[model samples]
Target: MKIGVVTFPGTLDDRDAARAVRLAGGEAVSLWHADTNLHKVDAVVLPGGFSYGDYLRCGAIAAQAPVMESIIKAAKGGLPVLGICNGFQVLVESHLLPGGLIRNEHQHFICRDQKLIVESNTTAWTNQFSLNEEITIPLKNGEGGYIATDETLKRLEGEGLITFRYKEVNPNGSMNDIAGLRNERGNVVGLMPHPEHAVEPGFGPDTKIAMRSGVDGLKFFTSVINSLVNA
Candidate 1:
């Protein structure tokens, strides 16, 4: 499978995302923010970064990029899209996912290893994990708090759209400790964690496997590849 990792100007983790794809036995296709074409990739990963220098909002500016126009259309058609951190912000801005990301409740940037529970394993990006399974990944962001209207929140919970929830502690005060969420169709997902940073061995979170051989995040990429194969 080929996964396209989109790189917007000022994006910091495109390379990492691409590397994770490669490690997962998929071709990593480089996608520019200005390009509408996805190069026929099977899936897309909107890596975390400070696009447009976070000028207007974390991802507000980048959400209007030429590439996002194509992404929005594709995503609606069931194309698999995973947005991480700032990319999650972009997803919300583009209306691909519901809710909004606000500043941290404490009003300071946070960077740390976070524990997340796999709330739903039915999404394309999270099928590799079992429900309620806990995994640690890196979380770093300032405006990562997730919020939605009460109605929207209830709808998501009622529909099982909540994919991942913070475990142990809520890092940025996301509502219900939501670390990630999936769209209604389960094709698009947005999360405020750096899973790409935990794919390789000897460099992931301090979990048992990560402490021995870093590979906690590998399932994320592999899950998409497996999904595409079965599709």
Candidate 2:
């Protein structure tokens, strides 16, 4: 399967996302932010980055890109869309999902290994993990706080849209320690963690497998590929 990784100007992790797709036994397709065509890719990954230098707000400008329009349309039609970190910001900005990501309550950029719990295993991108399973991935961003109104929060929880929650200390003051969320259809997922960074050996988070053995993130990419192939 071909997984399209969108690259906006100033995007920092498009290459990483593409490499992750390749490692997962899927073809990686480069997608330009201004392009309207999806190149017939099976899925899309909006990698983390500082698009438009985060001038207005994280992902606010990039959300207007033509590529995002196509992604939003495709995602609504049940195409699998995974948003990582800043990409999550874009997802929220585009209203493809609910809520907004604000600056960290402490007002500083954060960079660290973050532990997250897989809550809803129904999403196409997260089906490889067991429910309540904990995995650590690189988490880095300035504006990473997730916020929604009380009613919206309740709706998300009530509907089982919350996909992953922070397992360790709350990193960015995200409501309910939400590190990730999925749409009602379970085809789209938006998360503030950088799963693409942990797909390879000697460059991933340490785990029980081995030092630098945290390939837990690889399952996310591979699971999506498996989902597509099976579908």
Candidate 3:
């Protein structure tokens, strides 16, 4: 399968995301923010970074980019989309997923290896995870807090749309420790962690087995490949 990784100006992790895709056994296609085409890719990934320098609001301006126009339509039609960190901000800003990401309650940027639990593994991005499995991935963001109206939160909870939850601590004060979410169709997912950073052995997070050997995040990409193959 071919997975397109979108790159907006100031995007920092597009190459990492593409590498993850390649490591997951898929062809990585580079998609630019200025282009309205998706290049016939099978899936899309919005990588992390401060697009438009996070001016006005994180992802607010980049959400209006030409590529997002195509992405929005494709996502609604069941194209698999994964948004990480700043990309999560863009997904919320694009209204592809519910709720919004605000600044961390502590008012500072944070970077760490964070624990997350797989809440629902039925989504395209998370199908490789076992239910309730705990995994650690890199979490770094300034405006990573997730918020939604009470009604929306209730709806998401009731509908089983919550995909991942913070396992031990809420790193950015996301409501109910929601680290990630999926759309009702389970095709689109947005999260505030950098899964791409954890796809390699020596570069991944430290784990009990070995230093920087936790490659749990590789499943996020492989899951999509499996999903597409099984589809």
Candidate 4:
């Protein structure tokens, strides 16, 4: 499958995301923010970083980029879309996902390898994870706290759309420890953690084996490939 990684000015991890796509056995296509075309990629990944320098609000500017117009349409048409960190912020700003991300309740940038429980396997990106299965990934952000109104929060929890939940520790003051979410159709996903950084075997976050932590994040990309194959 060909996966497109969109890069806007200030997007720091676009190349890493593209590399992860390649390691997952998919062709990585680089898409630009100024371009209106997606180059007919099978799926899309919005990588992490401060687009537009997080000016005015995190992801606010990038949400309106020319490329996002195409992504929004493609996602709604059942093409899978995964957004990480600032990408998550863009998804929210573009209304592809619910809730908003704000400054960490502590008002500080937090960076760590965080444990997250996969709460839903119904999404296109998370089919490899059993419900409630725990996996750790790198989490780094200044504005990563997820928030929503009581009604929205209740609805999301009740509908089982919450994809990932913080475990062991809530790195940010995210309501219900929501580390990620999927749209109602499950094709579009938004996550705050940095999964791309965790896809390499030896270079990922410290784990069980010295210089050899397995890449759990690869499952997300492989799941999409499997889904496409099975479908």
Each model's lDDT: 0.91, 0.93, 0.94, 0.91
Best by lDDT: 3
Kindly list the per-residue Cα lDDT of model 2 for residues 114-202, writing each as its tens digit: 88889998889988999998898999998999999999999999999999999868988999999989999999999999999998877
**With candidate 4 superimposed using the best TM-score fit, by how many Å does residue 19's alpha carbon deviate from the native?**
0.9
Q: What are the runs in model 4 whose C-alpha is more than 4 Å off? A: 209-212
Q: Which ten residues in a row have the lowest lDDT in candidate 1?
A: 208-217
2 against 3, candidate with superior lDDT: 3
Report model 4's TM-score to 2 decimal places.
Answer: 0.97
Worst 10 residues of 3 by lDDT: 205-214
TM-score for candidate 2: 0.98
Clashes by residue pair, model 4: none
Model 2 ranges with Cα > 4 A deviation: none
In terms of lDDT, model 2 sits at 0.93
Clash totals in order: 2, 0, 0, 0
Q: How many backbone overlaps does candidate 4 show?
A: 0
lDDT of 4 by residue, 1-231 (tens): 999999999999999899888988999999999999999999999999999999999999999999999999999899999999999999999999999999999999999999899989988899987888878889999999999999999999999989999998998899999999999999999999988998888768766755437587887888887777777
